[model samples]
Target: MDGRRSDTRERIRAVAMELFTERGYEKTSLREIAERLGVTKAALYYHFRTKEDIVASLSDDLRRGIDDIVSWADATPAGPERAQEILTRYGALLHGLGRDMVRFWHENQPAFRELGFGVGLRYQFRVLADLMTAPEHAPLAVFHARQALLALSWSISMMGDLPLDDDECYGAASAIASDILRRM
Candidate 1:
């Protein structure tokens, strides 16, 4: 029963994300999500009362995923090798979370901003980037670290129109990120 309930929640999230991406978040409605899932609105309500709830749930998952990476990186020694590994793991996490959400974020920046998730996510990213280039913390090193992280993130987002699969995109992004870190 627990597993089934979890699956329903996941389905709702996936469908909601798709709807939110297609029609702007403000334009998407709970009824539309329920209709898309071929489920009753009450059933959808049992899991998420509002569209904001769905987005908040997804944002929580993303935050937890990033937190895990940041915690792991914090425990490891800071250096080029660790930096490379961090970028790889980060890329993998984003890939695992599905590229659609990343693309959604890129498209729905205003929605994220209104929800206050944009600022929090940005702060967390800068902190993670700083940690990746810790100890030295030189201006150039920080710039490169941010660039390396951006490269990995952009590969998932900017290349959305391309015909490449997630793994292919991640690989190319990881390779480029590795090169950037190596140079740093």
Candidate 2:
């Protein structure tokens, strides 16, 4: 029963994101989300009070996922293997966030910033970079690390129109990430 309730919440979020991406975030509303989900506005309200709540919910989930990576990286010994693991874990996390959130995040950056999701995510990313190039912190090494992380992230949103599928892109991006760490 609890699992089904959790599923209903996820379904609501998925429908809300579809509406948000189809019609810009500012243009989507709770009524439209409920209608699209074939539920009453009150039922939708049981989970999310506003459109911002929906976005916030997804962002919160993402933040928690990144937080887990950061915590693990902190506890793990500082080494290249740990860096690779961090990148791999982050890749898996972004993949689970769904393509719609990726599209919505790219297409709705200003709104996400306005809602304050950008700061926490940006900070978490910096922690990952630090984990990747800790102790020495050579400028060039840090640069490559940042670029590698960027490529891993871009695999989620920017490669949608490309010929490759999700696994192909993510696998390639992660390989590039490993090579970058090797160089450092």
Candidate 3:
């Protein structure tokens, strides 16, 4: 029973993201999501009462994943190797989570800011950069670290229309990011 319920919820989220992508987040509606899912609005409401709720649910997963990376980095000895691993893990997490969600994030910055999701994520991003440099936290190194992270993130959101497959594009992005990190 629980598994079925969880499946239903995931289905709703998937359909909702599809519709949101097609129609634009602000233009999409709960009715449209339910219609796309072939489910009643009430049934959709049983899982998510509003579009914001759906977005929030997706953001929560991303936040938790980043938090886990931060926790792991905390215990690890920090240096170039740790920073490189952090970039690798961060890219894997973002890419593994789902391209649609990252696309939604890229396209819906205003919505994220409006909902206060950006603050926590921005904080976590800085934390990751800090972890990259640990004790020194040198301004230049941190800047490079942040840029490396951005390369992984922007590759997901901005490179979707490229001819390359996900692995190829992600691999290129990871390489670029690693190069950037090595500069610091």
Best by lDDT: 3
How accurate locally, in lDDT, is each candidate? 0.86, 0.85, 0.90
lDDT by residue (1-184, candidate 3, tens digit) is 9999999999988888888777899999999999988989999999999999999999998999999999998889878888989999999998886667788888989999999999999999999999998889999999999999999898877887888777887888899999999988
How would you encode candidate 1's per-residue C-alpha lDDT over 103-173 as one tens digit per residue? 88778889888888888788878877787788788888888888988888888888978999988988998
Q: Which 10 consecutive positions of candidate 3 have the poorest summed lDDT?
A: 95-104
Q: Could you give the candidate ranking by lDDT, starting with the highest?
A: 3, 1, 2
Candidate 1, residue 79: Cα displacement in angstroms equals 1.2
Candidate 1 Cα misplacement greater than 4 A, ranges: none
lDDT of 1 at 92: 84
Better of 1 and 2 by lDDT: 1
lDDT of 2 at 42: 94
> How do all models score by TM-score?
0.95, 0.93, 0.97
Please report the TM-score between candidate 3 and the true structure. Answer: 0.97
Error of 2 at 135 (Å): 1.5
Model 2 Cα shift for residue 86 (angstroms): 0.6
Query: Which portions of model 2 show Cα errors greater than 4 Å?
Result: none
